[model samples]
Target: MFSKKWMNKSTNDYWDKISNLKKTIENADAIIIGAGAGLSTSAGLEYSGKRFFVHFSDFADKYGLQDMYSAGFYPFETLEEY
Candidate 1:
């Protein structure tokens, strides 16, 4: 299982937090963007619902896997199951 390092993380309301983020970005002399796989997913680019059903119908039928996010953590009994 993963550690709970984020257990104490908190955030303000969306508008307030986004406004501050926008200001911070605008005022920065340099900005860095990380291209981690989950970044786009976290920003709402999900592979779920109809997309998941279309691509992984077999997984859905066999294991009731609903979404790509959950599938990553699913303990399939075998590699073929995965």
Candidate 2:
């Protein structure tokens, strides 16, 4: 278990944060991580560019969607349309 003091240390030092994270991982019994689309995007799963244009060109044409992220909020009239 992580100490509250350790978790609450607000530091802007990048290497310090990495060291703390390393120690935390090393000491942990198990680890569970929750990540969002941004993580995938960082790992090269792009939301836009040629990939979006190729895969979602029809959706972009019909709904005026700009990217995969914005398309999620598009209010389609029915499930089939979505």
Q: Which candidate ranks first by lDDT, i.e. highest? A: 2
lDDT tens digits by residue: candidate 1, 1-49? 9987766544553678889889999999999886986888888787789
Model 1: runs farther than 4 Å from truth? 1-33, 42-44
Candidate 2 lDDT over residue span 1-82, tens digit each:
7666645445565778789899999999999989987789789898888999999999999999989999999999999988
Q: How do all models score by TM-score?
A: 0.48, 0.57
Give per-residue lDDT, candidate 1, residue 58: 92
Report, for all candidates in order, the number of backbone clashes.
Answer: 0, 0
List residue ranges in candidate 2 displaced over 4 A: 1-32
Error of 1 at 31 (Å): 13
- Pairs of colliding residues, candidate 2: none
Clashing pairs in 1: none
Q: Provide the global lDDT of candidate 1 against the true structure.
A: 0.84
